[model samples]
Target: MRPVPDRRLWLLVLGFSVWGSALGFVYVLHSVGCAFAWPANAIRLGLGLVLFVHLALVGLLWRSYAGTYPGAPAVDPTDSFLNWVILWTLIAAFVTIVFTLGPTLLLTTCT
Candidate 1:
């Protein structure tokens, strides 16, 4: 098993995952009749800012990942962070498409 992460790192990851999931859930609601249009870019910016702050706070915690743990392989922390940023960007794009194009598609079938 991997070593237990420090409390702060655990908390940081939990916070980000929850924040992202909550944002995603709200996007889903907007999809299904929540009335408000999804501001995908703005929400993406907010997520980026939150991630930056969290990373700065937990910067030290990432040092441990430089080397392999007992069972885990070595990982590049920078790449991992970048990967998450890219993943979030893609999700934002998908949400944007849903909000922008989905309605048009819905409108077409009825007319």
Candidate 2:
């Protein structure tokens, strides 16, 4: 038993593992020629570009925004936890999006 925080970190790791497993399955389906729509490469490229812009906006805002308070408690556990959750969720989503689109773009453009 590590600790509550460590356990939460493990849970987050598990969630990412599940996500990777699911993406792997999708790749298998794609390999066997079972994919629907055949995924237009142009669409993948366009969407990837759009996603990049969105990610850039998020990064800029994340750096520019400041929520610190002078009289706030030393450490608000709930706020910290929520921030971690939100940040990791966004990171996972971006990773998945890139993984999915990268292959599609390559397949489309290469073929």
Candidate 3:
């Protein structure tokens, strides 16, 4: 029988999965809005809100991980992997937020 993963590992995986799913959802929302000729301001506002929520969720995840596992040891492979995954996920989400906001800020109307 295969051993189940640790709770922390499961939490980390679920957190990142949700983060990635949110990113994709935002993209879909923007695309659908554009396709349907929604007002630029409306679409931008909605996307911005979604992005803000995503950032908040990711921040909470980071805080929770830190609180639960204070001063994780460097020698533990799972801890190190989880830390790296969380870091990269945050970076990716930040970059996505910037990309999504850029067009909204630069263009007043959908082209």
Candidate 4:
């Protein structure tokens, strides 16, 4: 089995991966909603729902972030650093989604 320290290394990519996926998904969703000539409220509602779900998923990722499992031998300081990096990366991703796509929820795009 891979060393525990390196097991979580793959998580480094998770934060921005989610953010980028959300960015593309939000853009496409909004575009489609506008193209369909959907009602203003309906479009915004859809946007709101998507944003909510994305945020929730990111929150879940935050809850799941861990650089080292408990009960295992303590790793070097890099493990704690990894923990902080994961925490902040997720935070940044969450904030980026909120500040960028969240505004569309409060405003109409199909009107």
The best candidate by TM-score is 4
**Predictions ranked by lDDT, top down?**
4, 3, 2, 1
lDDT of 2 by residue, 1-111 (tens): 222455445544543444454455445545543344444654454545654665554454344322432234664665455446645654665566567645654554223
Ranking by TM-score: 4, 3, 2, 1
Tens-digit lDDT track of model 1 for 26-100: 455435432344355544444455444444433433334333223334645644554354345444444543454
Runs off by more than 4 Å, candidate 3: 1-7, 69-109
State the TM-score for model 3.
0.61
**Local distance difference test, per candidate?**
0.42, 0.49, 0.65, 0.77
lDDT of 4 by residue, 10-108 (tens): 778788888888888788888997888878787777777777888888898888764343333665566666767888889899999999888877775
Clashing pairs in 1: none
Taking the candidates one at a time, how many backbone clashes does each contain?
0, 0, 0, 0
User: What digit string (tens of lDDT, one per residue) describes model 3 on residues 3-77?
Assistant: 336765565455556557666867788789989999988887887777678767767766665543525654355
Error of 2 at 72 (Å): 12
Query: Residue 70 CA error for candidate 3 (Å)?
Result: 4.3
**Model 4 pairs whose backbones collide:** none
Report how far off residue 62 is in candidate 2 (Å).
6.1
Q: Please, what's the RMSD in Å of model 3? A: 4.5
